[model samples]
Target chain A: MQITTFSFKRLLIYPVILIILLVLGFTVTAEKQPAWFQQAQDEAEQDGYKLITAHEMKALYESGENFTIIDVRPEYEFREGHILHANSLEFDLGDKLELKSDKQAALIGLLGSDKKQTIIFYCRSVA
Target chain B: MGYQNVLRFPDGFFGWKSFFSDNTQSVDTIKKLGIGDVFPSCRLVMLYDETDRAYLKIQSLQKSFALEDIGNPYLYIVIYNEKCLACVDEVQSFKALYKSLNESLYLSDKVKLLAIGAGSKKRGVIAFKKENAIPYPLFADENRSIFYCLGNPVLPTSYLVHIQPDGRRQILFVQQDHINNVEMLIQKIYSLVKDMELPK
Candidate 1:
């Protein structure tokens, strides 16, 4: 009887150890998010910019909604390819929405004094 | 800045192109270059000098070189975009590999490193070369001719080609994405080419 009891306990402990090891392996192999990713999330929240996916953007484009889409990549990249009806406005690296005086004027010109206009800005990636 | 209902498309052009079917002819649409494929012949304009400085226009730097002209036993072609920050960041890893090759007595003379800036103009290429202090030869593919010829690969694609004495060439290895570890890659290439005869 004692032998059977010990055998049962051993089986239970084996599974328990296996489960612990699996969990540890997963934790070790899990990819850690980059620092910039978290910072971008925080900035988006603080700046009140809504993040939309490609599908959502497609839906918005197909819905014919009265919205302005701007391609904020470099001129060459914009020339290479961009979404339909998206205006070109190049932004330097890491200069999200920080437009210079002339660029600000250009943005104002594209936006046309309407504070309620639905505007969207996109670049090479979310970064 | 005062727009209240502003939305941001995080996926940008690449994601949009991938999801939707539009008139935009993106480079990603083309098939990626893979192993067992012959490297395409394209003209590459040299933009940077040996000292890593941008060559002035008056320096008469309009000369271009063909891929077939580089007579090295092994050629490491790194295709990158100067405007792409991620691509620029990946250059450090290539630099490490270059340093390793230079340090290796056997591979130093046999391997040649070359960088092609896809969709990159001379000015941007110069600035990128200067900023990174890249020691390798930098070429600008402003019109993306070479990029298109190579199947419009994703930014930071590297191809390792083995050239034979009879002018036959074949891609030996390809790294289509960021290389996380240089040491492992060095060891891998070393093991692959350790027994190969050096070019005469």
Candidate 2:
């Protein structure tokens, strides 16, 4: 069989090119969730933290466990129909607020310099 | 995968009839949210997509979702799903539960109460499904994306979208409980709405 120069080069390089492309594709596809997500999820699990449900929260109230309820919604909405005693922690879902000052103010305002309180923070869901 | 922070009451408040009977009250002041036209600008989607989602120092959890639409006021009601509200006996009176739990639905004058529905998703479908929730926005985010963005879906699964005073379409607020955050959602709504109105 006679091999033309064009076909000859195609045969020699095609396999190598294909192999290289596949390697690159595999690397990119493997990277999915951001590192922060894994970190948050891991921290929650390792620390034995639990995400309480609304019903569970109700139980705590029924049990009369002393704890703070943080309502991380808007000010106006807080006035509407908030949990019995949950405090307001107004925030935007897509926007980031300045926590540097808010945190200090919040601690003083809610706990009154007492960081030992069993502060249970809850928003709209288990985000 | 420890889904510790997850709970599913599917039915919010409307389903747990007996217990919720005395606890639940439908408000007529709740109003419809959002403009009838296209969805508003993206600025109002003031979501916190970081590790510090709950770092805000606001006083109420309900603030995250409610808004005081100035020009054309809209009302949003937070529907507390019964089964989702408590663990039956352990949680005494729903009213005696939280001293600080924020629910944005109570803040009014800017919005009105069209109606409030709670219970299981199964029953809510028959009750709230006909309210024209096309994208049937419920709080049950199987992927956890919705909760991740909103900080948590404790009470009030999802907020009813509404237009703000600035003429931008946005989510009004929700009534979450955390079975999927049934009642607390309204609190989140208020904050989210104000964030939308924030200057830049």
Which candidate wins on DockQ? 1
Per-residue accuracy of model 2 over B1-200 as CA lDDT, tens digit each: 22223222212233222333443333223332322432322211112222112322223333133233223344342333323323222122222222122233334434333222232343443333334322212222223233334433334433455665566545544444333342454456456656655699
TM-score of chain A of 2: 0.51
- What proportion of the true contacts does each candidate reproduce? 0.67, 0.01
DockQ for all candidate structures vs. native: 0.34, 0.02
Instruction: Flag regions of model 1 displaced more than 4 Å.
Output: A1-36, A42-127, B9-28, B46-63, B191-200
Model 1: how many Å of interface RMSD? 4.2
Error of 1 at A24 (Å): 18
lDDT (CA) for every model shown?
0.74, 0.41
Candidate 1 residue A89 C-alpha distance from true site, Å:
7.3
How does model 1 score on DockQ?
0.34
User: In Å, what is the interface RMSD of model 2?
Assistant: 9.7
